[model samples]
Target: MKRVWIAVALLLAVLAGTLSHSFYLNSFTQELTGLLEAAEAKAEQNEWASAEELTQLAHHKWDEKTAYLHILLRHSETDEVYTSFREVAEFIQCQEGGEYSAANARLIAELELLAEAEQLNLKNIL
Candidate 1:
């Protein structure tokens, strides 16, 4: 009986960890997507200054979240996103609409892929 109880407790702890990780990943991706979208919108409007400001904000947020993410995510993917963030800022400064939009799209796709991988789904668990 004691052994069975210990097993159950361990199982519960694992489940809790998985769920918490999933929740954290989802929340982070949502916030980031919103930031990227705002930057893209500003670019669409030809508001280069506003777009640059929002892209900088996104970079700041990414830096703040990097420590936690580095533990949970693939280094290459995270690094790719970091690079994209920098490119987006540069494109915004140049007011290159096409390149700026493309960079934002790449960032959003990377964030989505990262979040999905972290989700507590059968595919990920298996």
Candidate 2:
């Protein structure tokens, strides 16, 4: 009876941990989606500085999402989207010799689309 109780306790602990991790991943993915949308909207309005800041924020959120994906799903479609957005964000950050407004705007739009698609995929999974 003591052995059976110990096994049951361990199973419950594992289940709880899995549920908590899923909740965290869902929250992080939603945040990334919002940041990407905001960045794109700011860029569309020609708010270059604000767009740049939001892009950085989105990139950070994507990084967190990617980390969670690595641990939970291990190279899912979201991981590919995260990698693409990370590359785009880095490219935008590196463009120092040109007028960044147009290029940044385009990148933001791309990031927004990618985030939306990823969010949809997450919705199906969840």
Please give each candidate's TM-score: 0.92, 0.61
- Clash pairs, candidate 2, are none
Best by lDDT: 1
Q: Kindly list the per-residue Cα lDDT of model 2 for residues 37-112, writing each as its tens digit.
A: 6765666676657766876887776665565556556365555565556554664565432434444445445544
Best by TM-score: 1
User: Model 1, range 33-114, lDDT digits (tens) per residue?
Assistant: 8988988998899988888887788789889989988887889988998988888888888888998888889888988998
Residue 88 in candidate 1, Cα distance off native in Å: 1.0
**Where is model 2 poorest over a 10-residue stretch in terms of lDDT?**
111-120
Candidate 2 — what's its lDDT?
Answer: 0.60
What number of backbone clashes does candidate 2 have, counting pairs of residues 3 or more apart or in separate chains? Answer: 0
Off by more than 4 A, model 1: none
